[model samples]
Target: MAEDFDLVKIMESGLEGAEYNKAKFPGLVYRIQNPKAAFLIFTSGKVVCTGSKSVENAHKAIITLANTLKDIGFDKIDLDPEVHVQNIVATADLKTNLNLNTIVMALGMENVEYEPEVFPGLVYRIDAPKLVVLIFSSGKLVIAGGKIPEDCEEGLRIISTEFDNLGLLS
Candidate 1:
């Protein structure tokens, strides 16, 4: 059956507790904050993606997550289109810190219009709908505008949260 869901929500929410453990088993595993929404991806092409949400969203989330990994350049895995839903898990929002200016610099100024600040760092807009706040290497980002601050906050949050969940937070 075709899975139904807002892929962006699933991806955004799922990314909260997702992790990538290169040392543990040489692959990626997403331990969604929702206990029921957890899964493991082994380097050997074995996957155990389970969640207790609407069976449709659960399946959709897994596929969306899996595709995201692939897009992010994770090791190849033969994904089963017929994904199975074992349980549904409650959703939890994981906290994170994102430095938009730094990210923009990292991504290059070609994508943004750079503006100087007296406090240090830079500010820019994304697609004209989002305001990005960036600090020097030592500063944290403070973003405003857009549907929400997520676009700005997620970058840093993903790295830390993913590392933490992968048992590499230290």
Candidate 2:
């Protein structure tokens, strides 16, 4: 449910902490420090907020932004709008270096992509939680494409268990 927003009005208002450069980016960038989040406000009234450490923090930041907008004369701003989380990213360590070759073989070729020339890390996809995990030789793993925190945790558990069952973890 997006509406047409007056980008020129917002920019001409000379707001304290908002930057808009249409030639560079079509959205107005508004940032807040408390939750360490940045939002991209589009003329279509769609706001893309990122960099919040947790879902709660993201909600807080959005509410704050909505309030600020209302105060700044955007009366159309909804104080209790429906929020949708795109994805959640999480990281972990295996405590031991992984052999990409072994992982590729054990995990199967379909859900795993490890091309050393193209990418240094192996891309492992999980179906249950619908996540993509990046496995590196240094034992560091980055899990992404999760809808919620629990999805991330579940994906990690699935991966760790797979490696553990195969005697891959030391």
Candidate 3:
């Protein structure tokens, strides 16, 4: 997290597509169109970048922002800043229909939350990878909260293994 940023100067720099409304939100929303990422820049110099599918893309986005800040006369801006991956989202397909009721019973009530009336997907919390996997009846899955791509892969493997062992996969 970068610290001690001059948010006011950044806002005054006439950054194209930069939205800063202190009354609406505390942070400035800077949209980087090239890498296709939105950065939530705070007065404290802390930036939260989202919409990046990979770490490389996130890093590139930050670099682009840093360059823009430098070009706008922002002092002490780090050109090569350290980028941290806080979360990763991934999707997968089981290639077969799944029964939410049976999955809930098999995975246990504590780990599974299936409410078709409210949502069609079953929310499965995996403790090992520390991620949440959304299992759908259409055999599609969405894994989120992973710090790395490997975490998503591991979470998928664990869930697939568990489902396979229980004969849940068709």
TM values, all candidates:
0.31, 0.92, 0.91
Per-residue CA lDDT of candidate 1, range 1-170, in tens?
12232323334455656566456555455665432556665544556765434555566667665665655544442344566433222222223344545455465766454554555554444453433434333434444432333444544454345336654323
lDDT of 3 by residue, 38-95 (tens): 9999988889999987888999999999999888987678999878889999999999
- Model 2: per-residue Cα lDDT over 32-76, one tens digit each: 998779989999999988989999999989998888788778888
* Candidate 2: stretches off by over 4 Å: none
Name the best candidate (by lDDT).
3
Clashing pairs in 2: none
Worst 10 residues of 3 by lDDT: 1-10
Candidate 3: lDDT over CA atoms?
0.90
How does candidate 3 fare on TM-score?
A: 0.91
lDDT ranking, best first: 3, 2, 1
User: Could you tell me which 10 consecutive residues in candidate 1 have the lowest summed lDDT?
Assistant: 85-94
After the best TM-score superposition of candidate 3, give how far the Cα of residue 67 lies from its true spot, in angstroms: 1.0
